[model samples]
Target: MENGTMPSYFYFTLFKDFVHMRYLILILTLTVYLAILLFNVIILFVVFKERSLHEPMYIRISCLSVNDLYGSAGFFPRLMVDLLFDTNTISRTACFVQIFTIYTFAVWEYTILTLMAYDRYVAICNPLKYHKIMNSKVTALYMALASLYAVFSMGLAIFFSARLPLCGTDIARLHCSNWSVVRLSCGNSTLNNNIIGFFVSATTVFLPAFFILYTYVRILIICQKISKEFRGKALQTCIPHIISFVNYSIASFCDIALSRYDSDKFKFVALFFSVGFLVIPPFLNPLIYGLNLPEIRKNIACLFQRSKVGHFPK
Candidate 1:
């Protein structure tokens, strides 16, 4: 150690705390990660292969699945590696990349959910104009815009964070994030970085969140005046999305709230809560949405049956 100063790379202590249970946790973590990957891929394949499922609504669902996959990809590989080794350190460059990937995935998710809510609103509230409102070209455009905006928003945060001079490099968790890296900077730079980070979150996160809630509320108000059959259809379409939305929102809140409060009394809270957001959505979205939607489920059944037929030739 030079001058007893911090290193250029940051070390994580997330697994050290659970050394006795590391193997079990690793096994469980791998299982969950695999499940998430498999299910999301199945959803993507089903939607891609099924012609009937090519409608705008299912396209948005597929995009949501893609978002889950992207988010999981940003974390799981790195996490699994950390679990397999004693060293839990990440270089500054790699940390910033992870921050970009995970944050963009998160922001993209919020945007897509907002987009989906808007799609549903248009479809139900103005059924006659669903075609005009969510046309293929328009849906594609929205998805592209969501992705672009997410990257842009996250890029700004990472750029500002990179400008700060590091005074320490001891990140205290299972993974790296913008805040973790920013916290290492000294003095006024730290405050300015935090202000930028908070601004980005407000613009990219809370506003979209507000729009999602507003759209759903409007949908609910409109539902009250619609026919029972139409309301039923709307509910069926929305419930799965709503469940994922709530799951993600809760996990994100837990992570943000508990991140700075890492007292002895709250040991493991930050690690679990921070990682929970990444784990829950990817695994949960496919199971909930795939089964709940009839066409995708039917396509999945057909795919398996075809595999069976091919395997056992008469």
Candidate 2:
């Protein structure tokens, strides 16, 4: 490593010890990757094909499925290749691209989830004006803004990270992260990186979290005044979103913890936390939304029935 020069490649030191189980892990990884594609694509196809399921909430779910696909693609293919070949090295360009893609997916996910919360809020708290407030154009605009913000924020973070000069190329985990790369810097850039990261996290993560809380609180207050029947309906709509949000939050916390305090003594736990965010959300989101929302569930059923009928030559 030279001063003020980035490493040509990064090595995942953790992968060295996992060579004996590479084949088994490769099979499992392939299975999960394919499942992620299948489930998220099913949601995407159902949302787009069924016009009846084209509400803002369903639209956001479709976006989430797309984001899941994007995020999974960033890691799974490269990971499968690494597993199959027992290689732990990733080129610098590919590494940072993965970082940017993963970060954007995460930030965009919360953005869409926040939008969904606001949609639920309007639908429940301001029923009569829901359509006017959340029309397709408005939804599009909100998504556009969110996408821009996700890209800009993560891009800036990557920009800052890329400026630092690396002194080492060994990453302790399976994947590349901004923090991991920043930690490799020979200079005293950690403090400055922390400050930038904090501000970025504040706007991209915490602000959306607080806004979601506010929307739910308002929804709760409105539900209390309304009849029990109405309350049940409102909560029914919210439960899936709530579950998805909490699931993501927990996974995110695990990643944060792993990054901050990872150690060889707790390698297994560290491994789980490292991949939890990528795995859990992609796996569970479709299940949560499909099973919980009758409209989506019904449409998905209809889609399968149609495929079955078409396949049987009826």
Give the candidate number with the greatest TM-score.
2
For 74-98, candidate 2 gives per-residue lDDT tens digits of 8899899999888899999999999
Q: RMSDs, each prediction?
A: 2.8, 1.9
lDDT of 1 by residue, 1-314 (tens): 11233356787766678778777878998999889989999899888877888898888888888888888988988887877885678887788888888898888888888888898888878889999988999978887887787778788778888877777777677788788777777666767777877888898779988888888999999999989998998999988878988988998888887766653466567667878889988888899988887778888888889888785212
In order of listing, the candidates' clash counts read: 0, 0
Q: After superposition, how far is residue 198 of candidate 2 from its true place, in Å?
A: 0.6
lDDT measured at residue 125 in model 2 versus the true structure, 0 to 100 = 87
Each model's TM-score, in the order given? Answer: 0.93, 0.96
| C-alpha-based local distance difference test score of model 2 | 0.89
